[model samples]
Target: MKHLFSVLCISAGSILSLSAQQTQKPILYGRNWMAITGKPLAATAGAMTFQKGGNAVDAACAMLAATCTMWDTLSWGGETQALIYNPKTKKVIAINAMGVAPTGATIEFFKSKGYNFPPEYGPLAATTPGTPGGLIYMLVNYGKLSLKQVLEPAMKMAAGYPIEAQAANSIEKGKEHINQWPYSKKVFLTHPGEKREAPEAGEIFVQKDLLATLTKMVEAESKALKQGKTRKEALMAAYDRFYKGDIAKEFVRGAQEQGGLITMKDLANWKPLQEEPLQVNYKGIDVFKLQQWTQGPVMLQALNILENFDLKGMGYNSPKYIHTLYQAMNLSFADRDFYYGDPTTMPKGPIQGLLSKDYAKERAKLIQYDKNNTNIGPGNPYPFEGKTNPYLNLLQQRGYEMDTTKRNFAPKHDLGKINTSSDDVYQERLLLGTTSIEAADKEGWVVSVTPSGGWLPACIAGETGIGMSQRMQSFVLDSALNPFNVLAPGKRPRVTLSPSMALKDGKPFLASAVQGGDTQDQNLLQFFLNVTEFGMNVQQATEAANINTNQLWLSLGGTKTEDRMPKPGQILLNNNTPSATREALQEMGYILSFGARTSGPINAIYFDWKHGSLWGGSSNHGEDYGIGW
Candidate 1:
């Protein structure tokens, strides 16, 4: 019933509310530019950059810095993966800023420690810091503003900013772990010996070490500029200092002293790569994602699988529609867990075959219309790539998927199949979150980035004020699980921070992303279908109720075999979902759990070429917000 068009804003009161559906927040319309992010303050940073005549890239970089500095579920040392639509080239470029596994990170090493995967937290779980280098790489190549301009908001926040309740609460929740690392304790615990160790809500929390680190980078850039270096060269000078100079030295020393494995060589050798992205055409629109190193392509694969079905005819959130979506997602994630990994590493997943339409049709055949397929596993995509299946023996050795009944108790009858408190610890890893950045301007530039890692409980490097990334936990320790993703030194993990882009009729159509780790692509896949197949506007699509399939190996958190295992037949749905739909899912083998908000804060922008304006959207899930003018 929501094919109604939306007029432009994020506040209440809508012109369409009288005759059509009403959304909690109104659409944000911008004639010149639009900036939407996970936090209102970060979005303000993007707006400030745009106001300074900076392009979308510059605004996005500023927001990235601000979100990291504010610790918006992420810190300055996390990974940054993005998709940029450059008006000049009229092509989408992928930025792979994900950090690589440091020295001593190997499957044998982790297994020797009596672990099935890398530890979930602490310095031992970190990779070489990637966010600072990533931010600089993006700013140098495509952004118009100087590093000083882009970092202003974040630097100010680092110096001293009023902390929000959400962040303060997170610090309190993680105080125990924060105390484990001296540097982290120094920065986060304002009242270490008191009952309330973390800062109170709205307190002017400051990070002097972080401020000094940021100032050092700025000083490096300023020195280069004064020496007659070009803007590009000056930016790279800052990048060098972070990765190869004093910053790198301090970061490596701090990490190693705290039992981390990162070496100065690892930091110096690691560099963010700018490469071509993979894409698929769905109903005439081209959807793009980063390479196999990320879980981004999973959305492209699901879109391909869903293309065979007439989604609109089944209707939105219909039982039949939900079933079909779950089935398609199931098939896609099966391949993702088994095959998706770093292409630069040996035993790389069959990237070409995985995205093939022909391959998708074959996978779709396994979807049973009547019952859930708990035994669903990876399909043979090698044949589609015109290669022999060398891992056939391994595939044959592994049979079926879920087997959690013995280790973990089932969810209560009232709660449905969604995992309950019994698996709360596991649930945290499956949904480890990140912040997203979506920026667009009238100049035809667009940037969609999903930056994560170095979350709360992170190990702060000494003097650097940088939190080491906990992304190493995303890697697999066995080839039998994911040959392409076997943990190794310098290899990137298959992360779930997926940013999205779409071009319709050879023009930029949409830029979208979400924050929930493994749920990022799943929510994004449906968010796109909401707009393209169901005709919902950007705002409505973002605010739309979505279902999450917990049928894949989680990309973050968890170390034991049982922790990484999937909860097949479990489904998470919006609380407002009709009883009939819930019953139908139960009948079809789904264990249904409900929540007021199932989505992980989807933020997006729809390029309204007809009106020559931008339409932005933020979900009702949490604190996500957007501004346009």
Candidate 2:
């Protein structure tokens, strides 16, 4: 452990060194392909698939499966959103596998229960599980591997594996909550009723129920294949068993038996969708993200606004650059809070207008070069789309109006001023995370996925070791808060899990993703700029100093008026930031806090089209890793 830490310091220094040096975890270089994710073993799962002659999609599915089993801040019941670059069609396609509010999830129901929003924990917080079906969907449609084959590494680990300190400590931290659910107690607690109930670091943690669950799915696939079903058909059979067969029965029975809203029909009704992703041209690169149902558009929106400026000329992380970036993000998130939501349902926001370059230009004009704009609200995009804004009155009721007269949301000197303890809870929710998967092969297939939900202290359904997603907390109960995003039965919440991909000269350029809720896009936006504007290599960009804004409404956790409220003018800066830059930001009406590692721990694959090689980057912030061959 001591040696690893020493090497890590060197790795971190290697990236920051002006002179050419080796990174702590060096950039992955491969002529054929590369795979990267949140855990070393999980990346190896993708590598195993690649070695088995799998395409990027197949390798990605394998990586997601491994991460879920290993609890890389997510699990099987979580949601998955992916952007795949199909070399054949030369088009980017989106996979939206986010689960919806289950039956009895109406706002009135929650309000009657004396809740501000959905409960933050337990069965009540769950949506239907989506990852299982999502994994099957991606494999059947875009992959050339069988469900049984893809799940091999995950199944092996599910049986038993030496648990890492991070996951073990998470179980320890969340043990109080885990104790609430009997099944979770059985799976996560290796020494229940002891001083430290959760497994110790490096303990061989085992989950027989989860292993059985995985075996059942593989069994279903095997049976279907033996009965003369095709590979895709067999995969669907496994999906059916999970959502409609015995597994579904047990999951529903277990959840409802414990207080969840999911019904068997809800499970059966939910299915993954394939759609066109949202895209914006930054200079000449075409960047793509999941559509309006997610916070993804926020990144594209910010990019459009930044496109109007000569970002390169401002210099990197300069006072002027940071100020412009912060303001643009606030502007984008203002629209996200008011307008972005489940576009598949009634009263969709002006998505067409929101993404319009002209609309972005109009919004960009609102930025003040000298100071931060704490009072910025959603801009009018109706004119650009040629449609009258239907809910103009609704827009006025934004629940996050700045109250400078009240305590400062982010006081400089006394950073621990308002909402002290509650601030930590709010930050956790705002940054409730997900694990990312990035895979690419020489065959031109590339996959970027951000899979989340069902982290530790997660409620496990009976008999099945699967964790239920707490994604229901992302919903808004009041239409006035966000008409398009207000909680309703069968409606998907606007999610924070976003994966990114970019194409240059009509070919894949970069595939990147990270696991910080609101900060996902913030970090990604800067990473893109680090490469495009500052000319940092992919590895440097992944480890680059970046800032985060708490100016957006919280997407996860909390249940009161103040809980989801915005923290205007509050920004998190890296501790290593120049004191001058910090002072410059504070003068611009910004309250600054600091962290050693600020980026998303972003993992990415940059297509070195020039050299005909693939360059991989896994950030130094966390345990994220990458492998290439």
Error of 2 at 490 (Å): 0.7
**lDDT: worst 10-residue window of model 1:** 1-10
* Tens-digit lDDT track of model 1 for 94-157: 9999999999887888898998889988998998888898899999989898999999998998
For candidate 2, write residues 1-629 as lDDT tens digits.
Answer: 34322321222222333225346677889988899999999999999999999999999999999999987499998898899999899999999999999999999999998888787789988888889999999999999999989999999999888889999999999988999898899999889889999888889878888888889899999999999999988999899999999999989988888888899989999999999999999999999989888999999999999999877766677667788899999999988987988888897789889999999998898788767876677777888999888876665444332332342233221122233123566677666778899999999999999999899879999888999998888888877767788999999998898999999999998899998888999999999988888778889889888999888788877777567777777888888877767777766778787777688779999999888999999998888999998
Clashing pairs in 1: 9-27, 417-591, 417-592
Q: Which ten residues in a row have the lowest lDDT in candidate 2?
A: 411-420
Q: Enumerate residue pairs that collide in model 2.
A: 11-24
